[model samples]
Target: MKTTRTAEGRVRAVIYVRISQDRSGAHLGVDRQREDCEALAERNGWEVVETYVDNDMSAYSGKPRKDYRRMLADLEDGTATVVIAWHTDRLHRSPTELEEYIDISERRGVTTHTCQAGPIDLATPSGRMVARMLGAVARHECEHKAERVARARLQKAKAGEWGGGIRPFGWGVPTGETATKFDKATGEEVEVPVLDLDKAVPEEAEALRVGADIILTDQSIHRWVRWLADKGFTSTQGNPIGHQAARDLLMRPRNAGIAVYRGEEIGKGSWEVVLDEPTFRAVVAILSDPSRRTTPGPEPKWFGSMIYRCGLDGCTETMICSRSGGANHPSYRCQTRHGGGRRGDKLDEYIEDLIIERLSRPDAHDLLLPGPGDVNVAALQAESEQIRRRLTDLAGLFGSGQITMAQFTEGSDMARAQLEGVNKQLGRAAVKDPLVPLVGAPDVRVAWKAMPLDQRRAVLRALMTVTVRPARRGRMPDGGYFDYETIEIGWKRSAQR
Candidate 1:
């Protein structure tokens, strides 16, 4: 944030240049400020023996400015008789900093100059008063500007527009570059991200396409990431995409054309949609609640990604597989006495045999297809309810005279507009479960058998839900043995479609 130079002279001076913001990343404001400061020193016949700068650093933050301190030290050491800056505000925005600087300048008898605010004599009361007033005004301006920027960004978010961070995956600028404008206030060039519509990131969009395919599962999503990396795909920062990152890219609502703010889906994004809502929701369900909710690890290959909960009659606990009967006999057992060890092969083969039989049916394919209608009516209904609540709140504000009629009308219109859009979308939504295609296929048995563990779990979700229970213990003629009953199956009625 600083630059320095050394020169020799008896009447030596140090120039302190500071800029609060450098949006262009070019440091142009600092450059111009330095130029003006140098010209001021030459006109006054002051020899600039050194230069100190604090670029893109705010004095109002109360953090020590390194060059500002170094310049002060140079003054105390008798290295420079006068200090110059683009303005006193550039030197400080804090009234406290001005007061402290006044003591130092007065004791050390140092003269300070600005290209715009003219010279300041800290030794006198009037000069000190002027500095204090300027400091207060500058601080006020800084705070007001910050508030305005924050409000602007919030409005953008509310409108479902892009606000911060790099362009999201599966989105890019159609124009291939952002527009630029000269900011008169800072005299610097700034790129405007809002000017151009970001379409899709091409290679990344293809990855989203692969994600939308019913064939791709969370297990396959990682392979896709590696495959894309091989195709030269990288993040906006040019870093290799990791496993979880790829899952988020495919499953996050933002990638599916929805705009989320603070963990809530606010509305549709202005960017082009990559995956349809049904496909996106399907991916989310598979990635969020399936057997392999996290990255694939050392789960036994025999488990087949099915999440089994302990379903012993009268026992309400989830089942976890563990080694039983010494080191080798594995079982899916319930903690309750009503539950007994269900042999791994017995249970696994039973479920697979069930799926193979169910998929082989003539009308079962229809069940695999997503049911027609709004995908998530609960979320949409909640949103609509919130809008009504907002309108009620706005009316209350108006009645209490807290807001003008114009303000109330504006707020009401915004809420109603959002409600209308949400209602329209809600009326139009039809859910297509992700696993519908696989099970609905003529060769569903082959497809089910060929599916990866994660994909197979998705199928389990689309067609039927399974629960296991321990059967009554059976006693042999010579001894006793443990046994489990057939699992309870709850098939969704939609599969009949």
Candidate 2:
């Protein structure tokens, strides 16, 4: 066994430093931490191998940084025997990350030292106990800070006070010590005196004009943001507002002269209201309306749109759903007259209805509602496992000089393609399950009536594999003979009743 003195002299160390945000004096913390870590390393006769510094990065979540994860990998691979930091909390606030480091220390024979907390020999039981206790304290501190900040926001919101952040579009921040308001409609300055808590309307209006209000309501802010964007207004950051950001702003109540923070109301005594009650209510109404809100360009027509195509040869024309002359009766018409070689024969509404009825029969249930059973699931899982194993084997072969680079690359590509195909099939199977029972149900007509256009299309695609040529007559059935002999109808399970 090696003596303690020899082991101590041979210890290799790495230093890690991190600061959450770039404050005016952020460099001071980084420099101080480095200095402390180096001093501890030198005092223990440990040879410092490398230094990893993460500036302006949070240790709370153990996310948003590549260097931090890389450090863990290095430790796991035995690249570093010891880690030195200013404090354990500086290394990690997340319990999971802390646990990972503890595991690495135990399995890889690594030790951690903090300038403030001294040596933590993770190989020993006492050291692990200390590390766990410290990790818990750090996690508590992070959570406590989050709770405190949340509480502060709630208090500020309840008072209808501006929480001292970026001003929204359609409003200007008050400059200096004096309060002033700008007219959004006229782009002119207006002298509006600040008011006490008694006068809510004027105060709120002033807040709105100055962009000092926090929206606090169920009303969506997307409509308002889009409206502002359409009017050539931008956010306080000089960036166009996104849908989600706009929604977040509108949902906050503080902008509407009411304050709510952390699920509680804490009205601000000094903050003035930005918008009048009537105007706020109107904005809310406009945002909540399904028709007025612009997303995906309207809900689209429920049926009778140009979404269907005739698949018959020589008659491969698109179908248009239209209402009969002077009537609300819907019908499907081929685009090309006499295109299908069957002259004067057109597909009528009745035939389409009959096809839908037939497809919805109980006998077609298996074709419509095929889901992944145990066999299919097991096959997919086994294929996935095989792909993973092949990749691993190829990597090993390459590493051991048993396979050429070209061969490895080719094998890897094939494995990846197979894996992708299996994944896609698995996804399709998931969607296929619902379609089977739906298409076979006897009451498919009712189902068709209730389903939206997109869902109807999905069912149509799953059931109909071939389009049947229709006997078409070009001119109206009651009129002179016209072009086109046949029309085509695709037979598939009907999702609609």
Candidate 3:
């Protein structure tokens, strides 16, 4: 190869190298390209001023290549009169990028050379045409490779195999005997992972199960966050599990042995189930409720803050917890300020005692619905599974070129809409009656105490409506105002004995 010299007497060159994937984190591919490029530069007597290498960076992914950008900057600054690479495809897999490179090279009077495809004079039309052609071929190969990879992944997902990523919590991949397969490329047998089945990580699985129960009972996700932190458990990234993380952890479909692809539930996975489907659905619904508060706010310290009603004349608004004028204790006052406040702690105690006494009755079991009422949980689950399978099949048809994109899109939209409706029904059905644990417990008081504030509040709201009537008389002997008579607990029709 003959190298052209600059007016200053020496030909300045820059070598650009890039490799798409480097699973070993070793730059062997780029290193080989760099070695070849250096040898070509040496043979041509071109002065190698810089070497730009973008390791594990794909030209087709449209991600920014830092070293490539730097090399371009150097070329623009007149630091190099020549650009060398292993091949024209190594320089660009995109036609638009090739055009830009051609424009820059033309303006800078810089020529490009490849160890394989030889020299490309950006200053001439023929050379630019050849570069564009090579770029187009590279783009075709990239798209083909992407299609093959997508199809392979979809097939794997359909087969209920692990799609491969960071291992999910509550599951462990065991070290088992490796299976060997004949490799056509190397003409030798290679050891492959037997079958990526994940077994239950006992402790993590138990934690997830407990989390599901807590979330299903309307407990705040913060409690689970605290539980995780106390248990010394962190996320796969080793970060302390926060409220959102806990919520997401409990909401994973994988916990229920359900596989998901691209945010859509596909079918059963190949992992051990950590949580039941109904419980998982219920927890997901609770955590994803739009009306649920996600902002930072104090948890309810009293059970009746929002459940108790302001029973003043013409003002039956819900009461809220409030502290008045440096009072040592907070009170439940009308949200609209229509009536006087009732001591929150006293009201909570009064309500809790009433609940314990009522649920302690022999007929407390009547409060629960007889076998899920009209929900048909099993049918809903089956229907949701069918819809998910339909969507997966539609995707397969589209990927395999059996259906046009338009047809696939329309079918998928309809199936997804159906799935959404069914999932919402599943979510609604997932709200197990909060009264189940308390109503039939051996000791209702102990069970009530063991229950979290949210669960207690849910039971209160469901069983009865407590109305805080106007205080009969102001201050009592202890300098506090709370009369049992002023607290009216009206049991709902569902709670009627």
Candidate 4:
């Protein structure tokens, strides 16, 4: 390409390059842009002053680009008389930014040049009009590209194709036997990277198991993060996981081999589930519940004990865990109105015994309704599977050119909407009572004591209600005393056959 030299002087030129994705992995795109812009500067007899690069940041993303901002600052300071880029769009994909550039160029007497699109003569009316039109086109192309990418990702999600840099916990990247390949062009042997999951990370899987089984004792996400850290576990990025990130991982349906898209679980996924459906669902419930984040105080000594309120008329206060007779005696005491307290150990034992008897019945399952929705989980699963198969078939037909893009798009959208609706329904479906098995175990007492406080609390709450009253005055056994009327237990009337 022929070009004229700078008639004024050897003007200093600044070249800027940016790339959103580097498919070549060697940053060849930016390198090529720099080389071409250098050649353009050489042709104009301009001094190559500096080069600015903003890698992996899209010009249209609206995210602040450090290098791009620095270049603009340099321009404002009158450090550069000429700006060089591979193309106009390489510098900007937004028309507003293009306007800013135009204003800056006219004000600073800076000439903008592209290695490919030639010089942008801002002084003339025709040049400005052409520049504006090119900027408009670039902006239009960017919007369309974004729309296309979003649609493609949605389609990929529907197909249950995992797409992310960080791997989900409890999952292992597979390794395979490497095959030697002789590259004919390069005359070198290369080992192919394994693409299958034949290996498992035992430590990662174990960490997930420990977390899933933990009772909802610590409501804070930080508790789990600290726990995982103590276990010497970190995220795929090899950094300590944050509270929000840990919660996100624990709540994902993908851990249960359930397909999810855009914050909704579609159905069973293609990958093997690390956790069973019930346990996974339980984790999600505990983490997602807004009430799980109570006021940041001390952890509860007894789960569900706070539910006990003062039964005395006109003096209502939720009982709290407190210590009695030194550290040896922990009790639930009502701080409001001083309604007295009950020994935590004794209260828990009585409740557990009551629960054991209630659940040991022949018709114990008739008590609580699963959930309000009462959705048939099996039928939902089947219907979702059918929809997935239909989608696959429709995609195949489109790929073979048997169906138009419009037809395929319409069909896919309809199927996805249905799948999402069903997923919402499934999420509300009541899971089997986890405590029921323990209740029906060989030894109810052993099972009750062995259970986590949260699990025991769940059973105690479902079967009966406990009312804790103040101890009788002047009654003592070993520095503390509680009358028989202090603890009152009642079975729910609705629970009766």
TM-score per candidate, in order?
0.63, 0.47, 0.83, 0.71
Summing lDDT over every window of 10 consecutive residues in candidate 2, give the lowest-scoring window. Answer: 211-220
- Candidates in descending TM-score order: 3, 4, 1, 2
Which ranges of candidate 1 are over 4 A from the true structure?
Answer: 1-14, 23-28, 35-50, 60-66, 69-82, 94-111, 140-165, 173-206, 209-232, 242-306, 310-346, 362-370, 373-430, 461-497
Q: Supply candidate 3's per-residue lDDT for 264.
A: 70
Candidate 2: Cα lDDT at 388: 58
Ranking of all candidate structures by their lDDT, best first? 3, 4, 1, 2
Is 3 or 4 the stronger prediction by lDDT?
3
lDDT string for model 2 (10-91, tens) is: 6777899988875443366788899989999889888787788888789886576667777777777667788999999888
lDDT of 4: 0.70
lDDT tens readout by residue for model 4, 1-497: 11122346667889999887764345668998899999887887888777999876788977888998898888888787788999998988887778888887787777789977988876567778889998889989989998898777767666666655455666655575676655545666678654333223677766665666553332345556667988888887688886777877877777777665566555565666676654565577766667665444555668546766666554557677777656687777776737556777777665666677776776666664465356677787688778877887887899899999999999999998997676555555634454555644777667767865555656655566667666678756656555656566667737751
Q: Which candidate is the best by lDDT?
A: 3
Off by over 4 Å in 4: 1-9, 22-28, 170-193, 197-234, 239-247, 255-269, 273-298, 303-305, 312-317, 323-328, 335-346, 349-376, 383-430, 476-480, 493-497
lDDT value for model 3: 0.81
Residue 121 CA error for candidate 2 (Å)?
Answer: 0.9
Q: Give the distance in Å from residue 23's predicted Cα in candidate 4 to where it truly belongs.
A: 6.9
Q: Rate the local accuracy (lDDT) of all candidates.
A: 0.70, 0.59, 0.81, 0.70
